[model samples]
Target: MTVYKQLLSLPENFSFRINLDYLKSTEDGLFRTDQESITRFIVLDGNLFFIKIYVSNNNRLVIETEDVSQSYTKQFERQIMLYIRDWFDLDIHLEPFYTIAKQDEYLKMPISKFYGLRNIGIPDIFEAFVWAILGQQINLSFASTLKDRFIKNYGKRLIHNGEDYWLFPSPRLIASLSMDELFKIGMSRRKCEYIRGIARLIANNQISREKLVQLSDINLAVKQLTAIKGIGPWTANYVLLRCVRYPNAFPINDVGLHNALKLAGSLDRKPSIDEIKQIASAWEGYESYATFFLWRLVY
Candidate 1:
């Protein structure tokens, strides 16, 4: 390991507390967090590093790593900065979203309640695809449980300070596993096949974040992703929203989105897809953020 320590500055108006609250809302076994810091494993330039991120009393963000040395080039620093920015969605300007949402009925309350909350993203394409597939038709809690099991069984682990930090299984690892191996982890055979197929596509370079990111149009991106087996409109849009950071990606069929809208409108039943679409039309360019804010209502 390279021997050095460093501090990274964050953008102005950053709210570590809000982001930490969102992170702690879910019980993720892969990363460990406390009131003071969040510890997770990150792979940079094929070298795995355990990173601890915390905020100083002066409201500055600090990223601590033990692997900074003469060998760490400017490219590595750029990669690290990009990863941190994407993970926290630091580039999005929320003032316009807030302005648009303030006039809207469905998003007014949620936006107010969860102000400063960014749509935390999954930076890894393979992890995002597998997560979207694993969560199909299942409730969020059980999906999280299955994810914990899958990660612990197939993912790499690093023990730091007597705690294990896990990296989500890579495509190469998943592609090499047999169907029976994944099914043994309590995932259905269909789910297993879907994940394995995605893994094979990724491992072979048939699909990648680089390719997806090249598509400037959100509809084109959705169409490209949906062509893969087991990836439907909802999954495609979900991946686009969470992983690709496409502002217009909207999963109108999402149950959580529907439920949140229903609760927000005080409706007797869940809103139909068309109704949700009509309601969402007001926030055209920032539908992903609106959807994320609504998810916060029920999740």
Candidate 2:
């Protein structure tokens, strides 16, 4: 019944490139299918700008702009699309698996269907870190409930056309909040300290998005992130996948992934970490893509 507009330019295959499918699985807030979230009812223009969208259950959004200059529209649409997708993670590229992926029956189905599924990408560096941490040892539903409360208490929001859209909290905002504040939302003391420590690092520029990207060696980034109190291999790998666009990144110990693999391949039991590594070996440089494909099997 109403419309809101943002000049979003979507790059070609930006949806596929950014691993939108991956983000949808990992990032709890961004890609919601529930009636309250409008992320699923999305469409794109030639330049990949989110020129039109309609959330089916609660309401509808119609683009009402009359500035219909095709040339200008296309150009600006491209810019806007790219910005939103990158901001929300819609154009990240993961290396391909080549022959190994082609040879694997498990991968063939997913590889073919990947572009059709929503690729997941996380744009917020700090939020990604926090999410990776929060999800460390919990079930997805519980993690989401915690995230809902966490964001509602700490995140900033914008009211557009009487609709509320939330922006994940910034480091500075989070750093200023007391641990007791976060704890009130069901976070354990250890998780609170972990979040605060990460915020302090980001606030002081001791660690930065740019710094992570600048490091060509993924090992170094993982090491640096692990140095933070509660961050470990899974968190670091999750951050790498969502924030830095690292292709080979996969949270090996993840229960969802472990189970998804077993189900996808029709195995009776979960694969050991070493077996998981070997199974993923053929996928090689595209472990992230393979991971994304496998993760899809469960959802």
User: Which structure among the candidates has the greatest lDDT?
Assistant: 1
Which segments of candidate 2 are over 4 A away from where they belong? 1-81, 85-95, 98-102, 117-119
Query: For candidate 1, what is the TM-score?
Result: 0.95
Reference-based TM-score of each model = 0.95, 0.75
Candidate 1 achieves a global lDDT of: 0.85
The alpha-carbon lDDT assigned to residue 237 of candidate 1 equals 91
RMSD per model, one decimal? 1.8, 6.9
Tell me the whole-model lDDT of each prediction, alpha carbons only. 0.85, 0.65
Return the lDDT, model 2, position 121.
56
State the lDDT of candidate 2 residue by residue for 215-269, as single tens digits. Answer: 9888888888888889999999888886777777878888878887887678899
Candidate 1 per-residue lDDT, tens place, 176-200, comes to 9999999998899999999999999
